[model samples]
Target: MAISIDRISKSYGEHKDVHALREISLSVHTGELFGLIGPDGAGKTTLFRILTTLVLPDRGSATVEGKDVRDDFRDIRTMVGYMPGRFSLYQDLSVEENLRFFATIFHTTIEENYELIKDIYVQIEPFKKRRAGDLSGGMKQKLALCCALIHRPKVLFLDEPTTGVDVVSRKEFWAMLQQLKKQGMTIFVSTPYMDEATLCDRIALIQKGSIMSVDTPENLLNKYQGDLWGIRTEHMYKALQDLNNFPSVTECYTFGAMHHAQVSGLQMPAELHNYLDRKYHKNIRVEKIKPTIEDCFMQLMQADEREPVPNE
Candidate 1:
């Protein structure tokens, strides 16, 4: 395994404890692109910090490339490249200076690893002389990736790299990540966007501090609970309550542009349409729709709320 975590846990507070991670255990295979998928405050950063040797976990153990994060902190620090969620480059320093500074810390010059970063660095090369603080959001992200790759570390950890970038930049950034993965580098990345989950080789869905599920995107989608139907009426808000109260609806919630109702086997689209038609609803549309990662996440969250998951 490139990364292995065992029953890791962390909490903060003096009088009242606030848990950030609860017995989180996950494994990333060698040279694999693994993603930590969740919403904000899901302990993604806490796990990253533990693996990167930035902070010690209050419980459990972890290793990166067979080196213990606690006992081999120095070796792990030198062997892994980490790009934090928030931009952390020296804002006053020019792009080139920031890159050079990071390169020097690993006892290597920009020339030594220039080839590894060329594809991404070239995008921001034109702004190499610009102060880090003056660059656009996308440009800043590019520079950060450059600095992180400048050392040519064995394992890469990126925390929400596309959080604040433009849509085009986000697309470009993932493309760059695909290129990097092709080069055989192990990457562990985290993002709150459910849409990004499908881009990963495998993802761990996390909420609060616990991992809800771990599987390939396809496998997760295949496990979506019940038959899903995309439903829309002239009055969406008013119909929401009606849909939820419908005897055949196993689950009902508004999902972008329409309400998604996971109905029981006894209900058909036409039956649902007729039921709503009797209520004087107009322009009703009910179609069985494919579920997305967001839908899977919602299902997991609802299940967790109904019954507490036993720790493994």
Candidate 2:
């Protein structure tokens, strides 16, 4: 295993304390691109901080390539490259300076590890003299990534790296990650974007500080048990309200241009559709649609309400 986390938990503040992670246990195999899928404040950042040795966990243990997070933090830091959610580089320093600075911190020169960052470095080299604060969001992200890879770390940790970037930048960023995996590096990235989950070799679906399910994206889609339909009416609000009250309806929520609903039982009859059609008093469209990862995540959230206890 490249990464092994056994019942890890973290929290913050005092009385009326907030529990960040609750007994979260997972492992990432060597040279795999693993993703933690969840929304903001869902313990993703907390988990990354603990694994990167920036913050200590309140309970349980974690290991990176068999090195304990708490006991062997120094060794872990040297072996892993971490790009935090927020850009923490020196604003006054130029792009080249930032990359060189990090290399120096690890007792290595940029030239010594230039080959490792060659692919990503090429994109940022043209703006090497630009101060980091003057760079665009996408450019800043590239610079940060190049700095992280300069030391040739064995594993990489990215916390919502593409969150605030443009669509083009996001695409370019993932391309860089794929190239790294080919170089035999283990990557652990966290993101709230559902579409991006499919790009990983394996993903952990997480929410409310707990893991709902973990599997290959294809397997998770295959395991969906309920029939889902895309439904839309002239009065969308009323349609949602009425569907939620229906005895046969298992899940009803707005999804983009239409409302995606799940029936509690197998095969919704035409008569049932007619009933909803008349109730809405407008021409409605009801068609069976393949469930996406977001649909699966919604189903998981509706099926459970238990909050994670610290280190359970």
Candidate 3:
């Protein structure tokens, strides 16, 4: 394994009551592109920090490339590259200068590791002299990734790297990751976007500092156990409330322009259409739709709420 974690736990606050992570455990294989999928404050950053040797877990143990995180801080630090969720590059430095700084700190140079970051660095090379703070969101992300790769580490940890960037930039960023994976780097990245989950070889869905499920995106979607319906009416809010009150509806939530409702039986769509027509007397459309990763995540969240995990 490139990374291995065993029942790790952490807490914050003076009373030690805020449990940030609860007995979380997972593994990433060598040269694999794995994702830790979650929203903000989901313990993704804390887990990344612990894996990169920046913080210690209150309990349990972890190893990176067979080196214990607790006992081999120096080795781990040298072996892995960490790009935090927040932009941490020096604002005063130009793009080229920032890359040079990171390379120098790692006892390497851009010339030596150019092959590792050429694909990413080329995108921002025209703005090499531009200050890091003045770059656009996409350019900033590219520069940060270049800095992380300049050291040419075996394992890479990126925490929510696409959070505030534009859609095109986000796409480009993932393309770079795919290229890096082909180069045999073990990449562990986290993101709140469910669509990005499908791009990874495997993903671990997390919520409120707990692992809800871990599998390939296809497998997770395949495990959705109920019929799904996409509903659209003139009044979305009212339709949502009405669907929630229906006895056969197991789950209902607004998804973009349509409301998705999970129901007990396949024949419920016609019944739903009629109910909406009689109640609201407006144009309504309800169709059986395929389940998505977002649907799978919502279902897992509901299950977790129904049976809360005890704090360690």
Candidate 4:
């Protein structure tokens, strides 16, 4: 295992008691591109900090590359690269200067580890003299990645690396990750985008500081329990509310312009159409659709809501 977490928990504030993480446990295999898929405040950042040895867990244990995070903080720090959620590089320094500074901190020259970051560095090299703060979001992302890899660590940890970048840049960033994975780097990345979940080798869907489920994207979709139908009409909003009030509707939510409804029994398009005709009296279309990663995530969240929480 490249990373191992067991029953890890963390909290914030003494009196207010904000539980940041709750009994989280998961593992990342060596050379795997794993993802922590969740929205903000889901404890992804907290878990990453713990794994990178920047913060201590309130309970449980974690290990990176067979070294204990608590007992071997120094060793772990050297063996892994961390790119925090926020842009943490020296904004005043030139692009190349920032890279050089990180390389110096690791006691290695740019020439020594240039091969590790050459592909990423070359993209931002044209702006080598540009201040880090002056670069665009995509350029800053590449620069940050280059700095993190300057030392050629075996494992890479990236937190929300594509949060504010353009769509093209986001696609390019994932392509870069694919290249890194080919070079035998164990990558652990966190993202709030549900579509990005499918790109990972495996993903842990987390919410409210607790893990909902962990599995390959394909497997998660395969485990979807019921048939899903897409309903679209001129009155989308009202139709959504009406579908939610339907007796047979198990789950109803909006996806783009259409509303996806999961029904309990084998009700075809005609039944749905007839039901809508009787109520809304509008020309509505209902088609059976395949469930997506977002659908699986929504189902997991609903299941979590029904689960009972233990007493402290």
**Residue 204 in candidate 1 has what lDDT?**
99
Q: Candidate 1 overall Cα lDDT vs. reference?
A: 0.92
Which residue pairs clash in candidate 2? none
lDDT accuracy of residue 227 in candidate 4:
85
Tens-digit lDDT track of model 4 for 1-312 = 999999999988985278889999999999999999998899999999999999999999999999999999999988899999899999999998999999999988899988888888888999999999999889999999999999999999999999998899999999999999999999999999998989999999999889999999999999998889999888888888888888888889999888999887765678888888878558789999999888998888988889864533
Q: Give the lowest summed-lDDT range of ten residues in model 3.
A: 263-272
lDDT of 4 at 41: 93
TM-score of each: 0.97, 0.95, 0.97, 0.97
- Candidate 2 per-residue lDDT over residues 179-234, each given as its tens digit: 99999999999999998999999999887667889999999898887788888778
User: How many clashes show up per model?
Assistant: 0, 0, 0, 0
Per-residue accuracy of model 1 over 168-242 as CA lDDT, tens digit each:
999999999999999999999999988888999999999989999999999999998787899999999988989
- List pairs with backbone clashes in candidate 1: none
- Superior by TM-score: candidate 1 or candidate 2: 1
* lDDT score of residue 284 within candidate 3: 92
**lDDT against the true structure, each candidate:** 0.92, 0.88, 0.91, 0.91
The sequence of per-residue lDDT tens digits that candidate 3 reaches over residues 101-144 is 99999999999999989888888999999999999888888899
